[model samples]
Target: MRPAYKQILEAVVVTAELTGSELSAHAQEVMVDDLMAYPLDAVLQALTRCRKELKGRLTLAAILDRLDDGRPGADEAWGVVARALGDESETVVWTEEMAAAAAPARELMMLGDKVGARMAFRDAYERIVSDARSERRSVTWRVSPGSDAERRVAAIVRAVELGRLPAAQAQLLLPTQAVAERHLLLTGSVMTEQERRAGREHVKKLLGMLRGGKVQVARTAG
Candidate 1:
Protein backbone atom coordinates (compact mmCIF):
# COMPACT_ATOMS: atom_id res chain seq x y z
CA MET A 1 0.00 0.00 0.00
CA ARG A 2 1.02 3.60 -0.45
CA PRO A 3 2.50 4.73 2.84
CA ALA A 4 0.01 7.58 3.12
CA TYR A 5 -2.95 5.21 2.78
CA LYS A 6 -1.45 2.76 5.28
CA GLN A 7 -0.83 5.57 7.74
CA ILE A 8 -4.38 6.87 7.35
CA LEU A 9 -5.86 3.42 7.94
CA GLU A 10 -3.61 2.84 10.96
CA ALA A 11 -4.35 6.28 12.42
CA VAL A 12 -8.08 5.65 12.24
CA VAL A 13 -7.65 2.18 13.71
CA VAL A 14 -5.61 3.60 16.53
CA THR A 15 -8.05 6.44 17.11
CA ALA A 16 -10.96 4.02 17.32
CA GLU A 17 -9.06 1.82 19.75
CA LEU A 18 -8.15 4.63 22.09
CA THR A 19 -11.39 6.61 21.97
CA GLY A 20 -13.89 3.75 21.41
CA SER A 21 -15.52 6.06 18.89
CA GLU A 22 -15.13 5.42 15.21
CA LEU A 23 -13.76 8.44 13.41
CA SER A 24 -16.29 9.43 10.77
CA ALA A 25 -15.38 9.09 7.07
CA HIS A 26 -15.09 12.85 6.81
CA ALA A 27 -12.74 12.89 9.80
CA GLN A 28 -10.65 10.10 8.32
CA GLU A 29 -10.29 11.99 5.05
CA VAL A 30 -9.22 15.08 6.92
CA MET A 31 -6.60 13.14 8.86
CA VAL A 32 -5.20 11.68 5.65
CA ASP A 33 -4.98 15.15 4.14
CA ASP A 34 -3.09 16.42 7.17
CA LEU A 35 -0.60 13.57 7.15
CA MET A 36 -0.15 13.66 3.38
CA ALA A 37 2.20 16.64 3.60
CA TYR A 38 4.77 14.43 5.33
CA PRO A 39 7.15 12.13 3.53
CA LEU A 40 5.48 8.74 3.12
CA ASP A 41 8.40 6.54 4.19
CA ALA A 42 8.98 8.45 7.39
CA VAL A 43 5.33 8.43 8.39
CA LEU A 44 4.99 4.71 7.61
CA GLN A 45 8.16 3.87 9.53
CA ALA A 46 7.08 5.92 12.52
CA LEU A 47 3.68 4.26 12.49
CA THR A 48 5.30 0.81 12.38
CA ARG A 49 7.67 1.56 15.22
CA CYS A 50 4.92 3.15 17.27
CA ARG A 51 2.77 0.05 16.93
CA LYS A 52 5.51 -2.50 17.53
CA GLU A 53 7.49 -0.92 20.36
CA LEU A 54 5.02 1.48 21.89
CA LYS A 55 2.94 -1.22 23.61
CA GLY A 56 1.42 -2.67 20.40
CA ARG A 57 -1.02 0.22 20.39
CA LEU A 58 -1.22 3.41 18.40
CA THR A 59 -2.79 6.83 18.57
CA LEU A 60 -1.99 10.15 16.94
CA ALA A 61 -0.46 11.23 20.22
CA ALA A 62 1.44 7.97 20.49
CA ILE A 63 2.69 8.29 16.95
CA LEU A 64 3.65 11.89 17.57
CA ASP A 65 5.52 10.81 20.70
CA ARG A 66 7.36 8.16 18.75
CA LEU A 67 8.30 10.79 16.18
CA ASP A 68 9.41 13.12 18.96
CA ASP A 69 11.53 10.44 20.63
CA GLY A 70 14.65 11.58 18.69
CA ARG A 71 16.17 8.10 18.97
CA PRO A 72 18.65 7.09 16.26
CA GLY A 73 16.28 5.46 13.77
CA ALA A 74 13.37 7.72 14.54
CA ASP A 75 15.17 11.04 14.40
CA GLU A 76 15.20 11.55 10.64
CA ALA A 77 11.60 10.50 10.20
CA TRP A 78 10.57 12.65 13.14
CA GLY A 79 12.38 15.59 11.56
CA VAL A 80 10.38 15.07 8.39
CA VAL A 81 7.08 14.98 10.27
CA ALA A 82 8.00 17.96 12.40
CA ARG A 83 8.67 20.03 9.31
CA ALA A 84 5.39 18.94 7.75
CA LEU A 85 3.51 19.77 10.93
CA GLY A 86 5.16 23.20 11.08
CA ASP A 87 3.43 25.47 13.61
CA GLU A 88 0.09 23.75 13.25
CA SER A 89 -0.08 22.75 16.91
CA GLU A 90 0.78 24.69 20.03
CA THR A 91 2.40 21.56 21.43
CA VAL A 92 4.84 21.20 18.52
CA VAL A 93 7.84 23.45 18.76
CA TRP A 94 10.91 23.46 16.54
CA THR A 95 13.68 21.35 18.05
CA GLU A 96 17.39 21.33 17.32
CA GLU A 97 17.42 17.63 16.58
CA MET A 98 14.77 18.05 13.93
CA ALA A 99 16.64 20.97 12.41
CA ALA A 100 19.87 19.01 12.29
CA ALA A 101 18.23 15.97 10.83
CA ALA A 102 15.77 17.43 8.35
CA ALA A 103 14.75 21.07 8.66
CA PRO A 104 17.26 23.13 6.63
CA ALA A 105 16.40 21.57 3.28
CA ARG A 106 12.66 21.67 3.96
CA GLU A 107 12.72 25.16 5.42
CA LEU A 108 14.47 26.47 2.34
CA MET A 109 11.74 25.03 0.11
CA MET A 110 9.04 26.49 2.31
CA LEU A 111 10.62 29.94 2.19
CA GLY A 112 10.87 29.85 -1.61
CA ASP A 113 14.62 29.66 -1.30
CA LYS A 114 15.63 27.26 -4.04
CA VAL A 115 19.28 28.27 -3.92
CA GLY A 116 19.39 27.54 -0.22
CA ALA A 117 17.60 24.28 -0.78
CA ARG A 118 20.18 23.23 -3.37
CA MET A 119 23.05 24.07 -1.06
CA ALA A 120 21.49 22.07 1.75
CA PHE A 121 20.92 19.06 -0.50
CA ARG A 122 24.45 19.38 -1.84
CA ASP A 123 25.77 19.41 1.71
CA ALA A 124 23.83 16.23 2.43
CA TYR A 125 25.31 14.59 -0.65
CA GLU A 126 28.81 15.54 0.39
CA ARG A 127 28.22 14.22 3.91
CA ILE A 128 26.89 10.90 2.64
CA VAL A 129 29.76 10.49 0.21
CA SER A 130 32.28 11.26 2.96
CA ASP A 131 30.57 8.80 5.27
CA ALA A 132 30.57 6.10 2.62
CA ARG A 133 34.29 6.61 1.96
CA SER A 134 35.10 6.51 5.67
CA GLU A 135 33.16 3.27 5.98
CA ARG A 136 34.97 1.81 2.91
CA ARG A 137 31.77 1.44 0.90
CA SER A 138 32.26 1.40 -2.89
CA VAL A 139 31.88 4.95 -4.22
CA THR A 140 32.49 4.21 -7.86
CA TRP A 141 29.75 4.51 -10.44
CA ARG A 142 29.34 1.76 -12.99
CA VAL A 143 29.82 2.52 -16.70
CA SER A 144 26.21 2.12 -17.66
CA PRO A 145 23.31 3.86 -15.98
CA GLY A 146 21.29 0.57 -15.50
CA SER A 147 19.33 0.85 -12.25
CA ASP A 148 22.34 2.33 -10.49
CA ALA A 149 21.47 5.75 -9.14
CA GLU A 150 24.88 5.91 -7.52
CA ARG A 151 26.47 5.62 -10.95
CA ARG A 152 24.39 8.51 -12.19
CA VAL A 153 25.35 10.45 -9.09
CA ALA A 154 28.97 9.58 -9.60
CA ALA A 155 28.74 10.74 -13.20
CA ILE A 156 27.28 14.01 -12.00
CA VAL A 157 30.08 14.39 -9.46
CA ARG A 158 32.57 13.76 -12.22
CA ALA A 159 31.01 16.55 -14.21
CA VAL A 160 31.63 18.81 -11.24
CA GLU A 161 35.26 17.70 -11.08
CA LEU A 162 35.79 18.40 -14.76
CA GLY A 163 34.31 21.92 -14.44
CA ARG A 164 31.58 20.96 -16.84
CA LEU A 165 28.90 21.85 -14.29
CA PRO A 166 28.43 22.92 -10.68
CA ALA A 167 27.68 20.25 -8.12
CA ALA A 168 24.18 21.57 -7.41
CA GLN A 169 23.30 21.91 -11.07
CA ALA A 170 24.69 18.48 -11.90
CA GLN A 171 22.70 16.87 -9.12
CA LEU A 172 19.58 18.68 -10.26
CA LEU A 173 20.09 17.74 -13.89
CA LEU A 174 21.13 14.07 -13.64
CA PRO A 175 17.86 12.63 -12.37
CA THR A 176 15.86 14.23 -15.17
CA GLN A 177 18.54 13.57 -17.75
CA ALA A 178 18.88 9.99 -16.59
CA VAL A 179 15.29 9.39 -17.56
CA ALA A 180 15.98 10.90 -20.97
CA GLU A 181 19.16 8.87 -21.36
CA ARG A 182 17.32 5.69 -20.51
CA HIS A 183 14.73 6.47 -23.14
CA LEU A 184 17.39 7.09 -25.77
CA LEU A 185 19.37 3.97 -24.88
CA LEU A 186 16.27 1.84 -25.04
CA THR A 187 15.12 3.23 -28.40
CA GLY A 188 18.30 4.52 -30.09
CA SER A 189 18.52 1.95 -32.86
CA VAL A 190 14.90 2.45 -33.84
CA MET A 191 14.94 6.24 -33.45
CA THR A 192 14.67 8.47 -36.50
CA GLU A 193 16.92 11.51 -37.07
CA GLN A 194 14.11 13.83 -36.03
CA GLU A 195 13.55 11.82 -32.85
CA ARG A 196 17.28 11.86 -32.00
CA ARG A 197 17.43 15.59 -32.68
CA ALA A 198 14.50 16.13 -30.38
CA GLY A 199 16.20 14.16 -27.62
CA ARG A 200 19.43 16.07 -28.12
CA GLU A 201 17.52 19.35 -28.00
CA HIS A 202 15.91 18.27 -24.73
CA VAL A 203 19.34 17.59 -23.24
CA LYS A 204 20.57 20.93 -24.57
CA LYS A 205 17.75 22.62 -22.72
CA LEU A 206 18.79 21.00 -19.44
CA LEU A 207 22.43 21.90 -19.92
CA GLY A 208 21.37 25.40 -20.89
CA MET A 209 19.72 25.83 -17.51
CA LEU A 210 23.01 25.13 -15.78
CA ARG A 211 25.04 27.37 -18.14
CA GLY A 212 22.48 30.16 -18.15
CA GLY A 213 22.16 30.19 -14.35
CA LYS A 214 18.49 29.36 -14.43
CA VAL A 215 19.03 27.66 -11.06
CA GLN A 216 20.79 29.64 -8.36
CA VAL A 217 23.11 28.73 -5.50
CA ALA A 218 23.57 30.52 -2.20
CA ARG A 219 26.72 32.50 -1.39
CA THR A 220 26.40 31.82 2.31
CA ALA A 221 24.45 29.44 4.52
CA GLY A 222 20.97 30.71 5.35
Candidate 2:
Protein backbone atom coordinates (compact mmCIF):
# COMPACT_ATOMS: atom_id res chain seq x y z
CA MET A 1 0.00 0.00 0.00
CA ARG A 2 1.08 3.58 -0.57
CA PRO A 3 2.51 5.48 2.38
CA ALA A 4 -0.12 8.17 1.92
CA TYR A 5 -2.93 5.66 2.07
CA LYS A 6 -1.49 4.04 5.15
CA GLN A 7 -1.12 7.42 6.86
CA ILE A 8 -4.73 8.24 6.14
CA LEU A 9 -5.93 4.89 7.48
CA GLU A 10 -3.91 5.18 10.66
CA ALA A 11 -5.36 8.63 11.25
CA VAL A 12 -8.89 7.32 10.82
CA VAL A 13 -8.42 4.48 13.29
CA VAL A 14 -6.90 6.74 15.94
CA THR A 15 -9.56 9.39 15.45
CA ALA A 16 -12.39 6.90 15.67
CA GLU A 17 -11.08 5.48 18.90
CA LEU A 18 -10.39 8.90 20.43
CA THR A 19 -13.68 9.06 22.30
CA GLY A 20 -12.68 6.62 25.02
CA SER A 21 -8.95 7.29 24.80
CA GLU A 22 -6.86 10.22 26.03
CA LEU A 23 -4.91 13.08 24.38
CA SER A 24 -1.81 14.86 25.53
CA ALA A 25 -1.71 18.43 26.91
CA HIS A 26 0.53 19.71 24.13
CA ALA A 27 -2.54 19.72 21.94
CA GLN A 28 -3.86 22.63 23.99
CA GLU A 29 -0.84 24.83 23.50
CA VAL A 30 -1.21 28.28 21.95
CA MET A 31 0.04 28.84 18.42
CA VAL A 32 3.43 30.33 18.90
CA ASP A 33 3.70 30.76 15.13
CA ASP A 34 2.05 29.76 11.85
CA LEU A 35 3.86 26.43 12.17
CA MET A 36 2.33 25.92 15.57
CA ALA A 37 -0.27 23.37 14.62
CA TYR A 38 -0.74 19.60 15.02
CA PRO A 39 2.00 17.75 16.87
CA LEU A 40 4.31 16.54 14.08
CA ASP A 41 6.69 15.11 16.63
CA ALA A 42 3.97 12.88 17.93
CA VAL A 43 2.90 11.92 14.43
CA LEU A 44 6.50 11.07 13.67
CA GLN A 45 6.58 8.96 16.79
CA ALA A 46 3.38 7.24 15.75
CA LEU A 47 4.73 6.51 12.28
CA THR A 48 7.92 5.15 13.75
CA ARG A 49 6.00 3.00 16.18
CA CYS A 50 3.82 1.70 13.37
CA ARG A 51 6.92 0.86 11.39
CA LYS A 52 8.44 -0.95 14.34
CA GLU A 53 5.32 -2.92 15.18
CA LEU A 54 4.02 -3.61 11.70
CA LYS A 55 7.39 -4.81 10.46
CA GLY A 56 6.46 -5.98 6.99
CA ARG A 57 3.14 -4.13 7.00
CA LEU A 58 4.64 -0.62 7.10
CA THR A 59 8.09 0.59 6.27
CA LEU A 60 9.79 3.66 7.86
CA ALA A 61 11.62 4.37 4.60
CA ALA A 62 8.35 4.58 2.71
CA ILE A 63 6.89 6.97 5.25
CA LEU A 64 10.07 9.02 5.45
CA ASP A 65 10.27 9.27 1.68
CA ARG A 66 6.65 10.30 1.57
CA LEU A 67 7.21 12.92 4.23
CA ASP A 68 10.16 14.34 2.30
CA ASP A 69 8.37 14.23 -1.03
CA GLY A 70 5.37 15.88 0.63
CA ARG A 71 3.60 13.04 -1.12
CA PRO A 72 1.68 11.75 1.89
CA GLY A 73 -1.51 13.75 1.76
CA ALA A 74 0.27 17.01 2.50
CA ASP A 75 -2.30 19.11 0.71
CA GLU A 76 -5.14 17.12 2.22
CA ALA A 77 -3.46 17.06 5.59
CA TRP A 78 -3.10 20.77 6.41
CA GLY A 79 -6.80 21.48 6.74
CA VAL A 80 -7.15 19.01 9.58
CA VAL A 81 -4.25 20.62 11.40
CA ALA A 82 -5.63 24.11 10.84
CA ARG A 83 -8.92 23.24 12.53
CA ALA A 84 -7.11 22.01 15.60
CA LEU A 85 -4.87 25.06 15.43
CA GLY A 86 -7.40 27.78 16.01
CA ASP A 87 -5.86 31.20 16.42
CA GLU A 88 -4.22 31.93 19.75
CA SER A 89 -5.29 28.76 21.55
CA GLU A 90 -3.43 28.53 24.82
CA THR A 91 -1.42 25.30 25.28
CA VAL A 92 0.13 24.12 28.50
CA VAL A 93 3.66 22.78 28.65
CA TRP A 94 4.27 19.10 27.91
CA THR A 95 5.47 16.55 30.45
CA GLU A 96 6.83 13.03 30.01
CA GLU A 97 3.63 11.51 31.41
CA MET A 98 1.64 13.82 29.14
CA ALA A 99 3.58 12.57 26.10
CA ALA A 100 2.40 9.11 27.02
CA ALA A 101 -1.32 9.99 26.84
CA ALA A 102 -3.08 10.63 23.53
CA ALA A 103 -3.46 14.22 24.70
CA PRO A 104 -3.76 15.98 28.03
CA ALA A 105 -7.05 16.32 29.82
CA ARG A 106 -7.46 20.07 30.06
CA GLU A 107 -9.80 22.00 32.33
CA LEU A 108 -10.61 25.61 32.91
CA MET A 109 -13.01 27.29 35.29
CA MET A 110 -16.19 28.63 33.86
CA LEU A 111 -19.12 30.33 35.62
CA GLY A 112 -18.57 33.10 38.09
CA ASP A 113 -17.90 30.69 40.91
CA LYS A 114 -15.13 28.95 38.96
CA VAL A 115 -16.72 25.57 38.46
CA GLY A 116 -14.48 23.38 36.34
CA ALA A 117 -15.14 22.76 32.67
CA ARG A 118 -13.06 20.09 30.93
CA MET A 119 -11.18 20.93 27.74
CA ALA A 120 -10.56 18.75 24.69
CA PHE A 121 -7.42 16.72 24.49
CA ARG A 122 -5.92 15.00 21.43
CA ASP A 123 -8.84 15.79 19.13
CA ALA A 124 -6.61 18.45 17.66
CA TYR A 125 -4.24 15.88 16.25
CA GLU A 126 -1.81 17.28 13.64
CA ARG A 127 -2.36 14.92 10.72
CA ILE A 128 -6.12 14.89 11.13
CA VAL A 129 -6.20 18.67 10.88
CA SER A 130 -3.38 19.25 8.44
CA ASP A 131 -4.94 19.60 5.02
CA ALA A 132 -2.38 21.31 2.91
CA ARG A 133 -4.28 20.24 -0.16
CA SER A 134 -7.34 21.74 1.50
CA GLU A 135 -9.39 18.61 0.94
CA ARG A 136 -12.69 18.35 2.77
CA ARG A 137 -11.68 16.18 5.66
CA SER A 138 -14.67 14.83 7.48
CA VAL A 139 -13.58 12.39 10.14
CA THR A 140 -17.19 11.49 10.83
CA TRP A 141 -17.75 10.66 7.18
CA ARG A 142 -14.95 8.15 7.44
CA VAL A 143 -16.73 6.26 10.22
CA SER A 144 -18.22 2.90 9.29
CA PRO A 145 -21.74 2.46 7.97
CA GLY A 146 -24.85 3.17 10.12
CA SER A 147 -22.62 5.17 12.41
CA ASP A 148 -20.88 4.16 15.61
CA ALA A 149 -23.18 5.20 18.43
CA GLU A 150 -20.92 4.41 21.36
CA ARG A 151 -18.09 6.54 20.01
CA ARG A 152 -20.51 9.32 19.17
CA VAL A 153 -22.10 9.46 22.62
CA ALA A 154 -18.82 9.42 24.47
CA ALA A 155 -17.43 12.21 22.28
CA ILE A 156 -20.43 14.48 22.86
CA VAL A 157 -20.39 14.04 26.60
CA ARG A 158 -16.67 14.59 26.68
CA ALA A 159 -17.07 17.78 24.67
CA VAL A 160 -19.72 19.03 27.09
CA GLU A 161 -17.79 18.04 30.18
CA LEU A 162 -14.86 19.80 28.61
CA GLY A 163 -15.32 23.49 27.83
CA ARG A 164 -15.26 22.79 24.04
CA LEU A 165 -19.04 23.04 23.98
CA PRO A 166 -21.96 24.46 25.92
CA ALA A 167 -23.76 21.65 27.72
CA ALA A 168 -26.98 22.36 25.87
CA GLN A 169 -25.14 22.72 22.60
CA ALA A 170 -23.38 19.44 23.18
CA GLN A 171 -26.70 17.81 23.99
CA LEU A 172 -28.09 18.95 20.67
CA LEU A 173 -25.13 17.33 18.93
CA LEU A 174 -26.07 13.89 20.25
CA PRO A 175 -28.15 11.32 18.43
CA THR A 176 -31.59 10.83 19.98
CA GLN A 177 -30.96 7.22 20.99
CA ALA A 178 -27.57 8.01 22.48
CA VAL A 179 -28.76 10.87 24.71
CA ALA A 180 -30.08 8.98 27.69
CA GLU A 181 -27.31 6.43 27.52
CA ARG A 182 -24.64 9.12 27.41
CA HIS A 183 -26.10 11.09 30.28
CA LEU A 184 -26.27 8.04 32.47
CA LEU A 185 -22.77 7.01 31.53
CA LEU A 186 -21.46 10.48 32.24
CA THR A 187 -23.39 10.75 35.50
CA GLY A 188 -22.10 7.29 36.42
CA SER A 189 -18.88 6.16 34.74
CA VAL A 190 -17.10 9.50 34.75
CA MET A 191 -17.09 10.11 38.47
CA THR A 192 -14.90 9.19 41.37
CA GLU A 193 -16.88 8.03 44.41
CA GLN A 194 -16.57 11.45 46.04
CA GLU A 195 -17.25 13.28 42.80
CA ARG A 196 -20.32 11.15 42.21
CA ARG A 197 -21.64 12.08 45.63
CA ALA A 198 -21.09 15.76 44.90
CA GLY A 199 -22.76 15.42 41.52
CA ARG A 200 -25.71 13.70 43.12
CA GLU A 201 -26.05 16.68 45.44
CA HIS A 202 -26.51 18.74 42.31
CA VAL A 203 -29.35 16.58 41.06
CA LYS A 204 -31.56 19.59 41.51
CA LYS A 205 -29.23 21.63 39.38
CA LEU A 206 -29.37 18.98 36.70
CA LEU A 207 -33.14 18.90 36.75
CA GLY A 208 -33.38 22.68 36.72
CA MET A 209 -31.19 22.82 33.67
CA LEU A 210 -33.29 20.11 32.06
CA ARG A 211 -36.36 22.09 32.98
CA GLY A 212 -35.11 24.90 30.77
CA GLY A 213 -35.91 22.36 28.08
CA LYS A 214 -33.77 19.95 26.17
CA VAL A 215 -31.66 20.75 23.18
CA GLN A 216 -33.05 19.18 20.04
CA VAL A 217 -31.11 16.03 19.30
CA ALA A 218 -29.23 15.77 16.04
CA ARG A 219 -28.09 12.81 13.97
CA THR A 220 -24.42 13.69 14.31
CA ALA A 221 -21.90 15.87 16.11
CA GLY A 222 -21.33 18.96 14.02
> Relative to the unseen true structure, what is the C-alpha lDDT of residue 61 in candidate 2, on a scale of 0 to 100?
29
Per-residue alpha-carbon lDDT of candidate 2 for residues 1-222, written as tens digits (9 for 90 to 100): 555434544553453234232323232121111112223553455444544444343322223323322222322333332222332232222222222222332222223221121122233323333332124222221111114555566655654554444565555556555535445544544445675556556665777677555543332333
TM-score: model 1 vs. ground truth: 0.26
lDDT of 1 by residue, 34-152 (tens): 55654566556656665566654344544444341222233343443343434332122222333343445667767877566656744654354334333434323212222445455
Best of the candidates, TM-score:
1
**Candidate 2 worst ten-residue window by lDDT:** 28-37
- Cα lDDT of all candidates, in order? 0.49, 0.37
After TM-score superposition, the amount by which residue 202's alpha carbon in candidate 1 deviates from its true location, in angstroms, is 39
TM-score of 2: 0.21
lDDT for 174 in candidate 2 is: 60
Best candidate (score: lDDT) = 1
Stretches off by above 4 angstroms in model 2 are 1-38, 57-156, 162-168, 171-222
Determine the backbone clash count of candidate 1: 0
